[model samples]
Target: MDTFWKDLEAAAEARDADALTELMRAAAHDGGNGEPLGIRYDAARSARNNVDKYAEN
Candidate 1:
């Protein structure tokens, strides 16, 4: 894995929720407002599912 992706994977594996959240925000920033990279739910099913709730609230 490239340094960036490797770091991301490492953060996810550590169960570092805040780190993963920051990573998502960074990706969205780098990808720009239009075609931004979305969330990465690498840990659990609830993680994937809670995403929409985040947007809605």
Candidate 2:
């Protein structure tokens, strides 16, 4: 398995929404997107629903 997290983190820190979206989608297709991208996804979803979590930001 190849790791592309460096690319993802750099993209995230830059706040590159397009890159972030693409990275998340790619990870999803690669079968592990949920854990990584879902951290933020679930966070956003939780915020919208008033659910709280201790998930990393």
Candidate 3:
């Protein structure tokens, strides 16, 4: 397996969003796409809140 895959797996297992985001940014750059990823923190926060709300039930 490639180092990139290993790193990605580790980041995923650790639930490191920043690490995953950085890895995705690097992958995009390497693939010739310079556009920045539009990570919607608001949406993520909303989803997390919903999950937490439901989990509390």
* Candidate with better TM-score, 1 vs 3: 3
What TM-score fits each model?
0.49, 0.49, 0.50
Which is the leading candidate under TM-score? Answer: 3
lDDT of 2 by residue, 1-57 (tens): 545467656665565556656655665456444466455444333333332222224
lDDT tens digits, residue span 1-57, model 1: 224466566665565556667666566555333433453323322342355456568
TM-score of 1: 0.49
TM-score of 3: 0.50
- Model 3 per-residue lDDT at 45: 37
Worst 10 residues of 2 by lDDT: 47-56
Quantify all predictions' global Cα lDDT against the true fold.
Answer: 0.50, 0.50, 0.51
Write one digit per residue (lDDT tens) for candidate 3, span 1-57: 235556666665565666666666656445323334433333333344554555579
* Candidate 3 CA-lDDT value: 0.51
